[model samples]
Target: MVAYDGTDFSGFQVQPDQVTIQGEIEAALHRLTGETIQISGSGRTDAGVHARGQVFHFDTKSGIPLDKWRFVLNNQLPDSIVIRSVEEVSSEFHARFDVKVKEYRYCIDNGAVPDVFRHRYADHIRSPLDVEAMRQAARHLVGRHDFTSFCSAKTVVEDKVRTVYDVRVESEGQVIWVICRGNGFLYNMVRIIVGTLVEVGQGKRHPDELRTILLGRNRELAGKTAPAKGLTMWEVSYEE
Candidate 1:
């Protein structure tokens, strides 16, 4: 398992002339084993997003003990990224394909003034939100649907159907969190959902309108994509 502050990354993928999570790990692997390695991540998070439970798998011939891999990698990695754990898995296991569920969290600082400490981790929204309205809007998204309206227009995936198992809106003091758990998600889907919910909270859109937007299947029908800094990949799960 890995956790990273993605603010400095171009994205999770390896890109020429760009710093990325995969690139950094592959470089570390090369330094440690003298062999180039490529990793497959559970998802390719966009720039500025964070991950507390991102997962990746790579093939290696080195004799490094599984328990010691985490320490070895962390020693070589930048402070922004950490290897939380390492374990041997079946040769047949695939990180991206074996995923059974993914959880994402979007944080909002609803204080009258943005918290300086959380500027990079949370979205600061000064307007008082109607939590109940946001909850109602979120409920409409908790099911199987074609999320074309919520995903980015730049998305290349032709199939947009995915199951959102749950959506919860919770608050603590000045922070409001929108938690989403699903079997899968389209690119930019979670952020757009949060944006639409925020609109509902702000009384600019009705809670019931989410259904209509989903049915419309037009990206323009949904609200703006929420800023990436507020989002985090909280967890990923797989079948035992």
Candidate 2:
């Protein structure tokens, strides 16, 4: 397992010459084992997104003890990335394909006062938001349906259908948390959903309009995509 701040990395994928979570982890692994191996992650988190329980898997031939792997690899990795644990799994195990569910959380700072501590983790909006309205709007998104409207225009996915099992909004003090659990999600899907809900919270649209917008099946019908900094890969479940 791995947890990363993801602020400085380009994204989770290993791109050509760009700093990324995968790139850094692979580099660390190569340095530790002297063998270059490719690692596959559970999800491809966008740049500036954080993850608390991201999982990855790779086939390795090294005989190094599993307990020593974390120690040696983490010493080579930067402070932003942390290897939470290392385990030897069967060859059939695949991190991405074996995932049964994914839960994502997006945090919002709703108060007028700026929180310096949370600037990197939560999206700050000075304007007050109606939490109840946002909650009501989220009800329309739960269940299996086409999510083309919530996906990014940059994405080329032909099959836009996805299952959203639950979407709940809650508030504590000045921070509002939007938690979503789904079987799978398209690129930028959760961020877009949160943006659409924010529009309802701002009184720009009625909560009931979300149903019509969803049926529209057009990206233009959805609100703007929320910034990546506020989103986090909260958890992932796999069938044992």
Candidate 3:
């Protein structure tokens, strides 16, 4: 497991000439093991996004002890990325394919003035959000459905179906939280859902209109995609 601040780099994937989370980790592994290791990540987070418990796996034949991996990697990795834990698992266990559920959290600072410390972490929205209305609007999203309306227009995935187990919106003074748990999500699905819920909280859309949006299955009917910095992959689960 790993936790990272994704403010820098071009997301988690490796691109030629682009600094990425994967590229850095692979480089560090090479420096330690004298072998180029290809790691498979649980999911690819977008640019400026964050992850608290993101997962990745790689097959290594090096003599390095498993217990020393976390310490060695952290010493070599940048401050933005930290390997939280390192353990050996069966080769059949895949990071992305074996995921049983994933949880994401989107944070919003609804204060009159944005906090300088949270600038890289949370989205600062000056407007007050109607929490009750947003909660009602999110209820329609808690189930298996086609989420095409909430997906990005640039998404190339043909099957837009996904099962969302839970959606909760809550606020603590100036901080608003949106938590989503699901079997899986499409590209930019969580951000679009947050944007739509924010629109409902701002009274720009009726709470009941969420049903229509889901049935419509058209991207144009949805709200703007919330900024990537506000999002975090909170946790991921696998079945025993």
Candidate 4:
């Protein structure tokens, strides 16, 4: 498992002339084992997004013990990233393909005063949001559906069908958290969902309008994509 504050790096995937989570880990692996390695992550988070339970898998023939691998690898990586745990899994396990569920949490600072300390972690919204209305809007997004309207129009994937198992909104003091769990998600899907719900909370749209938007199947019908900093890949689950 791994956790990272991704504000400074690009996305998780490696790109030329860009710092990324995968690139840093691969570099550390090369320096520690003297062999070039590639690691596959459960998801490729967007820039400025954070992850608390990101998981990856890599093939290695190094002699280092599994228990020692965590400490040794952390010593070589930057403080922004941390190796939370190291374990040995079966050879048949594949990190990306074998994922069963993913959970994402988006934080909104709805207080009148923005939190400077959490500026890097949460998005600030000064306007009062109707949390119940947001919850109502979120309920419409639950279950399996074609989410073309909620994903980025630039996404090239032809199939937009995905199963959202749950979506709930709650408030804790000044922070409002939107939690979503699904079997899979399209590019910017969760962000767009939060945006649409925010519009509903602001009384700009009715809760029932989400169903119409989903049926419209047009990206333009959806609200703006929420900022990436407020989003976090909270957890990933796999079969036993």
* Candidate lDDT values, in order: 0.94, 0.93, 0.94, 0.94
Deviation from native of the Cα of residue 171 in model 4, angstroms: 0.5
lDDT of 1 by residue, 1-240 (tens): 899999999988999999999999999999999988889999999889999999999999998988889999999999999999897889999999999999999999999999999998999999999999999999999999999999999999989999999999999899999999999989999999999999999999999999999999999999999999999999999962
lDDT of 3 by residue, 140-178 (tens): 999999999999988999999999999999887688999
Give the local distance difference test score of model 3.
Answer: 0.94
Q: Candidate 2 at 168: error in angstroms?
A: 1.1
lDDT of 4 by residue, 33-59 (tens): 999899999999999999999999999
Better of 2 and 3 by lDDT: 3
TM-score of 3: 0.98
> TM-score for every candidate vs. truth?
0.98, 0.97, 0.98, 0.98
Off by over 4 Å in 2: none
Worst 10 residues of 2 by lDDT: 231-240
lDDT of 2 by residue, 1-240 (tens): 999998899999999989999999998888877898999999999999999999999988888898898888889999999999999999999999999999999999998996899988999989999999999999999999999889988889789888999999999999999999998899999999999999999999999989998899999999989999999998999962
